[model samples]
Target chain A: MKKLLLSGMLAAALFFAGCDGTSDPALPPSSDFTVTFKALYDGQTLEKFKSYDYDTYKVNFSRFNTFLSDITLLKGNEEIKISDIEWVDFTPDSAFGNLTVSVPVKFKNVPDGDYTGIRIGYGVKPELNAKRPNNFQSTHPLSRENEYWLGWGSYIFNKVEGKADLDNSGAFGTSLVYHCGSDAVYRTYTFNTPIQVEQGAAATVEFDLKKLFTINGSWFDMKIPANQFTSNDVGNVIVATILMDNFDAATTVIQ
Target chain B: MKKNNAGWTFKISTFSAVLLIFLMLDACKKDDPPVEDRDDDLVAIPYNPKSYTIPKPEIFPEVPVPPDNPVTVDGIQLGRRLFYDPILSADSTQSCATCHLSSGSFTDNKDVSTGIDGIAGRRSSMSLLNVAYVSRPLFWDGRSPSLEDQALRPVEDPIEMHNTWANVLDKLKTHASYPAYFRQAFGITSRKQITKELAAKAIAQFERILISSGNSKFDRYLAGDPDALDDEELDGKLMFFDEGGLLGLPDAQCFHCHGGITNTGFSFFNNGLDSVASLNDFKDKGRGEVTGNINDNGRFATPTLRNVALSAPYMHDGRFNTLEDVVEHYSKNGKGVSNEDPLIRQLGFPIPGTNPVKYSGLTEYQKKAIVKFLHTLTDIDFVNNPDINNPF
Candidate 1:
C-alpha cells in the first residue's frame, strides 16, 4: 500500500513538472487552440472583380493586405497575450497558400476557460510601428517587402488596392489604391462576445470587409478622386478614419 | 533503518536526474556568437590607427556615420584614388568620376551619362554635394540603403563600369599600392581580406567629406549679413519660404517638399509627371519598381536644390535642359495623374475676377525672384573644393 501511494505521488509530480507553472488547482488544465480569421466582401468571401454595389458605383478588390498584431484574449481582465504578428494577404497569389480565404492564428498552452472578449490591434502597435522594415527579423510581418513607405518613415498598415466603375461602363476604369499607414493611424479593435474555449478546440473570428467599407447605409465610394489615398497626412488620415469607424461594427466572433 | 536508506538513495538519484536535465537544456540553449563578436576570434594583426574627422558646415546638419565603417584618413585617400582610377572598370578606361565630374557639381553635363562602352545610362547622374547628410535609401528611387551600398553598384553595372567584383578584387589584390592601402585603412593582415565591402567603405568615407560649407550668399544671409541678399532675392526667399503674410508676397509653394537647409526632405513623390489610366502604365516604375507597390509608380526621391544652378539638365530623367524649364514645368503644374501627390495638385494664384487657375502659385515676377533665390544656394566653394577632387 505504501509503495503504491509513493508511485502515485511520483506520477502526479512528473505530470505537473511538464507544465509552465501557470496551472492552478481551481482552474481547468491548459490546452492548445486556434483563432481563424476570415476576410469577406459584401457578405461573401473575397473574389477579384466580384462586383459589389456601393452608393453610386460598383467596386472590386484586386488586392488586400493588412497587418494584425498584439492579439490578446481577455478573461475578465486576465490578459492572455499572444506574441505573434500576422500579415493577412487576401490576394489571389498569396504565399500563405493558393486560394486560401481564411487565416488561422494558433495559440498554444492557453489556460482553458471562458474568454469575455478578444482584443486585436488592426496594425502594428505604436511602439513597434516606428521601427523600419530592415530593423525587424526578415520573417517578421513588419519586414514585408514593398509594405514600408521609406520616404514617409512608416509602414503601410493596410493596403486596399482595387478599381471602381462609377458609370457601370463594364470596364474598371477608375483605379482605387488606398495605402494606409502612419503611427497616428494604428487602431485597436475589441470584440465583446462570450467565447467558450475547450481543450484542443479552436475558436474562430471573422472580419467582414463589406461591413468595414459601409458607412451610413452607403458603401464607401472608392471612385472619389481624393480617396485614392497615399501616406501623406491628408489622404492617409481620411482613409484611416473611415477604416477605424467601420472596423468595430464589422468584426464578429463566429465560434 | 532500511527505509531511511531507501529514502536517501531516492533523493540523491532524483537530484542527479534534475542536474543532468538542466545540463542538457543549458547545452541546447547555446547559440552562435554575433557576427561582430566572431571577428575577435580571428588571429590578431598590427593595426595602424588613423582617424578622419569630417568638417561640419554651419548650414548643414551633423553627418551620420555607420558604426561598422568609421571614417579614416587612409580610407578617404584610398577612396579618392579609387574614385578616379579606371582600374575598377572592365576596359580600364572609365571611373566614377567620368560620369560624376567635379566641375558639373559631381554630375555629367550630358542628359544621360555615357559609360566606358559609350552606352548611355537610363537616368542622369545625381550630384554628390552634401550627400553625407542624406539619410537611408540613397539613389533617385531610394533603393540602396546606404552610400556604402550605392558605391558597389556602378562597378558591376553592365552599362556602367562592367566589371565583376571578383575581377576587381583580384586586380586590387595584385596591385602594389592597393594591398598596403587596404591594410592601413581596414587593419587587414593580408590582401585576401581586401573585399568589396572595405572598398565601398573607403569610397563612402571620401563621399562624407564632400560637404557644402556655408559660403553661399544664402548662407551669409543666414549668418546675419543684412546686405547679403538683394531686395529681389529677399522677395524670392519669402516666396520660397511661403511666409506670404509676413513678406506681403505670394507663396511659391516650394517649401512643401524643398525646405530646410538641405533644401529637400528626401522623400519620394509622383509630382504629377504622367496621366496614366492605370498604375501599370508608368514608363519607368521609379520608386514603384524598388518597392513593388503600384501606388508608388512614377515616384522619385526629391533631389536637393543646393547648387541647382551648376547641376544642369535637372530631373531624374534629365528631361529639363535648364532650371528655367524646371520652373516652367512647375508653373504649368504637371499633367495630373491618378496617383499624383496631393501637394502637387492645382497650385496657382487667384486671377482677378476669375476662378483660381492651375499652375505654379507664383506670378512671372515671383518665378524670377524664386529662381534668383535658388542661385543663392550655389556654394562655389563646395564644387571647387580640392580635397574632394579626383586623385589620379
Candidate 2:
C-alpha cells in the first residue's frame, strides 16, 4: 500500500509538472459569454397576476416555465454547445407584486469571436427525455417530480398556467392551463441573429407569452373550453402543436 | 544505546519546517484528505463513525447532504439523546420531543406549541418527517435555510425551548456522557471544543435520517400490488393523482401542491386560507414578514403529508382538527384572496348550484374518497421506528 501510494503521488506530481506554466501552450483569449432570458408579455416586461388584453378578451398568467437544452452558438457550421438541459421559471415569485423575477443564466469560457446566429433545442431533448426523474440526482433540473407527467411518460417541457377572462367583466375566472410535453412536440429552432462574443459581452433571449397563443397575427380562438392540452385528444394535440410552432416567433435575441 | 537527539522540540521544528515548505510550494498540487486546521489539543478517541445514507426507494430522489456534515450512526445516536434530554430547555421541563412526539408523527397534535414558560407560540409545531428534502429557506415563513440552522432557532426562540446556547453548551461540556459521545461522533479532542454549530450538525444528522419506510398502502398499490387498496381507496388514488381517464372522475387537484413521492412539492403557496382585501390585510403575513414583500404576505411552505393521518390539526396555524376539515377547506376553493395561487380557486369540480360565484367544488363522496386516499399515505413503521425514537 505504501509503494502504491508513493507511485500515485509521484505520477500526479510529474503529470502536473508537465503542464506547468512554463510548458503552457498558446491559445486564443477566451471570455465568458453570458446568455440571459427575459420574460415579456406582448412587448413589455411581464407582470405576473396582471390582466393583459388578448385581442378582445383578457388573460393573466401566473406561471410560465420551459426547459432548454443543446443551446449552441452557430458560426457558419462550427457549432459550440453552450448549455445542456436547463429549467427557467419566469413566474414572478408570489412575494413581489412589483419585483421582476427575471434572473440571467451565465456560461463560462468562450473564445472571442463573431457568430451569425444561435440554435436552441426546446425542452429536454430526446436522449434526456427518455429517462425519468429518479434517473438523475435530486439537484438536477430534470429531477423535479412535479414537472414530470406519468401519463405522458415525458417531462412537461413547458407549463403556462393562468386564467382567461371569458368575458370583459374583469373576472379572470376561466382557467387557462397549457402543459405542453411529450417527445413528439419537442422543437429545435435556429435564430439567424447577429452575436459577438468578447470580454464581458452579454446577450439576452426574450420570450413574449402572448405571442405563443397568437399564431400568425390571430388570437387563440376560444372555441373550446378551458384546460387546453389536458389529454391526448387530437384537438389537444393540434393546440399543443400550434403553441410549439409559434415558439420561434415569440422568441427574440437581443445582443 | 543513545537517544539519537530526536527530542520533542526537534520533532516540532521538523513539522513546522515541512508545513512552511509545503505552503511555499504553491505550484505543487496535493489532494485534500486530512481535513484542514485540526486542533492538536483535543484528545483522540475511536471516531470510526459508521457513515449512514438515508434509505429511500429508487423512485424517490435522494436528499442532498451538506458536504460538511455527513450523517453517521454515532452522530444520530447522540442527536437522539440530545433531542430527548431536557438539558436543552431553560426549566429542564421540556425537550425537542416535548412538542415533536413520535406518536404524533413528530408533531404535538396541538393548535399552538407552548414553551418552557407556558406561553403558546403563534404557529403550530411542524412535522419533521422528510424535512431534509425541503427547499431553501426552511420553516413556514421560509425564515431559516438548512436543518442545522432550523435546529438552532427553537433553543433561542422565546416561545419554544427558550434557552440560551451559552447555557446549553456549558451543560454539554460538563455533562456526564455528552463529551465522550461528541468525541465518538465528531472526534472532538476536548469538551471545550463543543459549540452550538457542532450540536446543530449532530441534530440535523438525526433529523435527516427520519425518512419514511415507504411501505404505505399507496406505495404498495403503485408498486403493482393489486390487493393493496380497497375500491374506494383505488378511486381516491385515481382522483388524487388525476389518472382517471374514460371513467371521468373529477380532478380533486390535491396533487398540485401536495404531489411527488413524499406528498409535497416543497414550495410556498397562498392556499387562500383567508379572505383578505389586500395582501397586507393578512394577520400572519407569513413569508412576507421574512421577505418584506407584500405580495408574499399569506404564502406558506407546503408540509409533507407522509403521515398525514398521524399529523392532525393541519396547516401552519392548526386551523383544522381532522383530515375531513382539511379536505373541506380545499373543496371550498379557499377564501378568494387575489394573491392566492391562480390554481387554488380552480378545484376542477363541477358545480350544481352556485352558492359561491368564484368556482365550483367537489361532491360529498369525492371528498370522502380523497380523505380515504390520504389515509393510505400513513406509514405505521415510521412512527414505530426504534432508530428514530428518543434514546433517553
* Every model's TM-score on chain B: 0.84, 0.86
lDDT by candidate, in order shown: 0.72, 0.79
Residue B347 of candidate 2: its Cα lDDT?
A: 56
Instruction: Supply DockQ values for each candidate.
Output: 0.03, 0.24
**Residues A1-72, candidate 1, lDDT per residue (tens digit)?**
999999999999998896563466656577777888777775677765467776676776656678887888
TM-score of each: 0.58, 0.84
Q: Chain A TM-score of each model, in the order shown?
A: 0.83, 0.85
Worst 10 residues of 2 chain B by lDDT: B32-41
Give the CAPRI class of candidate 1. incorrect
Best by lDDT: 2
Error of 2 at B146 (Å): 1.5
| Each model's iRMS | 10.9, 4.0
Model 1's alpha-carbon lDDT is 0.72
Candidate 1: regions farther than 4 A off: A1-255, B1-46, B351-361
